[model samples]
Target: MESPKIDIITLVENLAYQQGTKGEHGLSFVVRTSGRQILFDTGQSDLLVQNAKKMNVDLSAIDAVVISHGHYDHTGGLPAFFEINDHAPVWLKSKAFDEKMSKSTGTPRFIGLDPEVAERYRTRFRTVEQVTELAPGLKIVPEIGSYYGFEQPSQSMLIKHGKTLSADLFEDELFMVFEHSEKLVVFAGCAHRGIGNICRSAMSLTGCNQIQLVLGGTHLKGASKGRIAKTVDAFRDLQVEHFGLCHCTGLPAFMEFSRVFEEKVRYAHVASRFEPFD
Candidate 1:
């Protein structure tokens, strides 16, 4: 039997591929498979809606919305999304609403979604606590554990507990897996939990070793040389066939990946379209 053709259109990203489409420091994708349209992440603003309009994508037709994590850059367009689509349920992990902070600049800055939006559109959210099948052949894998100590969570990210702050383990982070026979197509957002860990989790959950393609942010910006080397080695060991990385993956890591992966790597910019099963 032939596998279903999955069409992924980049609705928002850090780089614009087309002239009319604008770019921002965020990520979003329109994934079409099994006769359904799934909106994966909504970038950081109304740029999602604007880019969708420019690219001829109808937000009103989305069957579901999957938020990869609670970061504002990934969930900031929820208000705009809900303003347009009234039926599609927004799926996310329970901890996605926790107060997330970033201290990369030595000054704590809030990076979670807007509380007002979360309150106003509370009814639209469907928080999942475990592995869930969103649609036929489409699974949402959450609570990714770090098997590799080198793939640790960023120490600069914190979760605010009232006044005290602690390292954000990113329990709210999740990744999407599209099963196609013995192969899998993984979609990650920022990959705050680590891309290698995300891939391993997907393979373990689905029991599939062949990752046909991996697309999304890796959060490897400013990562240590040792970390990048380990990640590259991990990907090679995982046998990932293709990579469409972007956003926070960082130029250094991208260059290293391209140099190592060669023709197997491609930058997934705004307006980029990927048909993994084609």
Candidate 2:
């Protein structure tokens, strides 16, 4: 059977504009294809609900929710989300339960999804710790058994019972790769799993090195210029033709990628949509 063309709708993002300047926190995207609806991740706050309301996206009809990782900014809206649609299965990594931290100042923070919320969804949702295929053309990246020398590991922590500890490179961090027509589209979260490494493993899983489009956060905030440049060069090998970078991608890094990729890189603004043709 031939794959169906994929359509992505950006319902929530950190940079949402209500009228002029004020905005909310977090990011959320919806992917629809083959008569199924999949939500990539929920933003850090309830703006997802408000955005969906304003944008007219019905949460009740969504089939599944794929959490990139367990950061509050990405999974914060789950409690509110569950209140609206309690039946959709939630997919995430098993190790998403870790401490989060600040890389530059080494400050501790609350970054994991609410345990109460996660536990509540445990009955209806599904969690995977390894590379498991969820549906046709969709798979979750297994745990990071080893961290290759692509880039320095992320500096974050998960707060539990008022105790601060080094955050584990949660193996639960995963990305999705699906075939749209003849090309592959990668849906990533914060990319806590090194972006380059994620691409490498995703390629290994799909047996296709050519990525036509990439969406979601690259987590390149505060990245060094050399590292960003090297990443762009590596992308040349992957032949990524389009980019929809948003959320934690940071302004400076997004501009850098745009400078290099030109028309190929398009900023994924809040309330945006992309239609990939077959």
TM-score of each: 0.98, 0.89
lDDT of each: 0.92, 0.74
Residue pair clashes in candidate 1? none
Residue 124 C-alpha lDDT in model 1: 94
- The residue ranges of model 1 lying beyond 4 angstroms of the native Cα positions read none
Cα misplacement distance, residue 95 of candidate 2 (Å): 1.1
Put down candidate 1 lDDT per residue, 101-196, tens digits, no spaces.
Answer: 999898999999888899999999999888888777888887786767788889999999899999999889999999997899999999888899
